[model samples]
Target: MPIGMILWRWDYRSGAEELGKYPKELDVSDKTMMQLYSQHLYGAQSDIVSMYVGALNIISVWTGSTHNYFLSLLLTIEEQPEDYKEVISDLLYYLIPFIEEDTFNTLLPSIYQRCTEFPSTNLEQRRAMMYGSNLNRAIFKTLSEEGCFYRDELKIWLEDILKTKLYNFEYIIDGLVQNDILKTSIVRGVDGTYVFLLKYLICFRAPPLDLSQKIKIAKDNELNQKILKKIRDFFKKYVPNEQDNIEIAGYIRQTNYWVIIDFLRKSYAKHSSLTKLKLHGVDQVMNLVNNLINSDIVDIVVDQNEEQVYFLKSDIILDFVPMNYMINQIYNMHVEDRKPDKLLLSYISILKENYLESH
Candidate 1:
């Protein structure tokens, strides 16, 4: 039978409980397409590749519900006995590139979970790891190569996934730290988490920064001295001299930045405009504030009196809607099970009324 015929059977598989299973004739030959054709099994040999391509094209054009159902079947198929595994694996290799990102994310965690679940045999376990890792690497490559606009989105997704996998930091230290995936090429456009990982390897395992160089960074500046003191104290306490200290400093910086961002976020929600951030109260987080300003997420104005005022950027309000609106919508959705997106969009529609009028 033609490959397309097999796929048609698979797609319209009748029994819900046996969703992914199909006739064994589809798995008859592991040989090349030409070999199958030469044997006069499925008519022309070229039909093998052509039919498989046709099935993929059909799947790609499926509506959301149909696409989801197809994924469900593939997921089920992968978990079937080893004899049926190659078909699912081959299909995933071709299909994953065409899968919508949201769908890929939805299916990936479950696939990963299965990979980690206990296997009946050593061979099965190895196969699980091989397939799982290949899928991960493929997804990462696709996302990273996807354009500049998606860089941060991919980074955030990877960081979230890695966090779930690496229950303890040591797993990263022992495993991924030395991996080529974290090498500069792969992490080029991403953000903090990857940077922190590389830094950890350098600071802990690489030669410690020269004492003189460290002193130079701290100089006679009071703020520099204070920040350096905190960083040094963290490293001294947590870093083994023989290991890397980079992650410790990074963890401190990340935590400090998060705290500052959280404070500003809450303040922005409660009061759309902030006349003062009390920077003096969080001098250690000055770097984060400067970074925020550069990113245009927050606006800081210094008046003639030298008093500082901070507000969420107007574009943020227009793009994401107000935090207050989000909170209220979330509450209604939780309690009343209302659709918040429509309401949120309506609020966002009118959000810039005053700003536009003033301009």
Candidate 2:
């Protein structure tokens, strides 16, 4: 018998809840492929087809729709050529890449450059960004009504909304700060914490800058920053036709990750009641997920139910979609009364079998 052959149910097993929350796999290879693909980094003589396939695979995962569904999406994107610049503003998290060490420290500057460019693309993403997170709404509401907020002051307010004590709440604040959704103003003789004051936010921003004026500034800054980015990129990666190649890759990798990461963040945050960049750090996460395709060799055999199992000497199979996400998905489908997914059942059994000496 084969795994995923029958309609296996999760509720029938012990530790059913744990099994449902088991992490999906994020293969190391896949992770690297995604990062490199995002930056338009590829082999010296890489063919376009390999690149396209990876992009298609990424888009599929990002959309929660199938990878095969990208032909029309890609076509639509291509038809609107300016579409590449379209940034999803309320992206739940933006990866803040922290390089191990460097003389020039090009990575951080590159990210800053990326930041100034996003608003330039259009306000469509801003509209999307405005309403995506509960934290965003709470912050907006507090700032709207109170006209200014202190960090500690805001947390007490949120605790009331959530009906539970929030841990690591600083991470939520950190994410907002890093993403530029929030900025800080230090009080004169107060505790010396530079919290984002609402008046400071609206004062300089609202009166002097009209939307079109802001867009023009962003667009000009984007062009200048783009040049700096390309110069840095060309010097570091230095390949012929790199910019054109990156343009192609950006369509699938860089821009859409904005879309996909937002989607994934929203999905996970919904059930977990957390925001981005807390569970996730800047590229330090490498854990096992159940559904990832692995190159590891382990036992392969059929169980009594005629389902196949994967066993390793050390523990169960490991892949990397970050386990908590799987839990979120299970809760979602369960509440919606959808048919059970076969692969999900397979994942459950595989995860369940992980602790057994032999199955």
Candidate 3:
């Protein structure tokens, strides 16, 4: 089920300047901020209720503002009993969904900092922020199933979160696109289905590093071997016979290897490099490594037996965590209502399987 009405609280001081700068005078009294917060909180809740009344759906309550006065108190919600009790009471009495402790912990600081940059004047901008806000919630919900999102899925997700059209959504998309942090393209499926693509421009950063440069960096980094091996294993297990050696190698060369390695270690430490080899067999492992080297994703210096080797150049590992997290969230949203597009699901499923296997 979708999260119930969520209540988020922030300090009023963090955004005091913006609030002061608001063209219209905001009801700034202590009671006024509380009332405004409660109003928005309840409004969101009511909207959810109207949409799913009498259904077995959850209602989440989130509270907080980007005010400085509330900062210390907000920080205490998770660890301080009195603060926690107060927030809990506020939520419980409203029959709202209780924010998970970890989630609350994750969100508090972010909201606090974000409120400081409150450009509340533009309605479109505010709506865009709200849309992005939901993405964070979605990420928390989806961390396990997929590891990347196709562009079309992102467009749909933005629509749902913003409750608006693509034309209106351009405000946010433009920023991401201009930053080179996001890319939109047309992708052709094996079945002849064509779709728009939204993906992180990990390899398209400023002063773009060419494929060979990336591969050289990867070779120089010792971690590429482990990452390449993981990628190969992932494909072998879930996407057998579908390996795009060039594409996979290129991705690795463009990616940030150390970061990927760190994330892999954190998420799947039990299946470390050594453990994977023992389970998958030595020859299979060797062949995969050889493929990566042959693809020029890595430069390898091998011993006489051609067994023991080291990478001489390689690319930095691009961060795919956000993509992965987005995929998981979409998966969960699909599970709740089964509304995610099939093509999107298929693409992400492929990504998830490969990522999980590689890790």
| Highest TM-score scorer | 2
lDDT of 2 by residue, 10-81 (tens): 122331111110012312233433443332223442211122333232111111111110101111211221
Tell me the RMSD of model 2 versus the true structure: 29.7
Which has the better lDDT: candidate 1, or candidate 3? Answer: 3
- Top candidate when judged by lDDT against the true structure: 3
* Global Cα lDDT for candidate 3: 0.35
Q: So what's the TM-score on candidate 3?
A: 0.21
Better of 1 and 3 by TM-score: 3
The residue pairs found clashing in candidate 1 are 200-247, 203-245, 204-243, 204-244, 204-245, 205-244
Whole-model alpha-carbon lDDT for candidate 1: 0.32
Candidate lDDT values, in order: 0.32, 0.31, 0.35
Q: Candidate 1, residues 251-352: lDDT per residue as tens digits?
A: 222334434444554332222222233443444355556665564334454434454544333111101111223344445554774433443343333333
lDDT of 3 by residue, 1-359 (tens): 11111233444455222111111221233443354344444674421111122222222223222211111112211222222222222222222121322234344333333332232223323223322233322422232233234545656765576564443233334444554334443434433322222333222111113432454464335444454554444335542121342244333322123223223332222223523643432334445445545644344343334444334223322232335546656667677754446646565655555467556
TM-score of each: 0.20, 0.25, 0.21
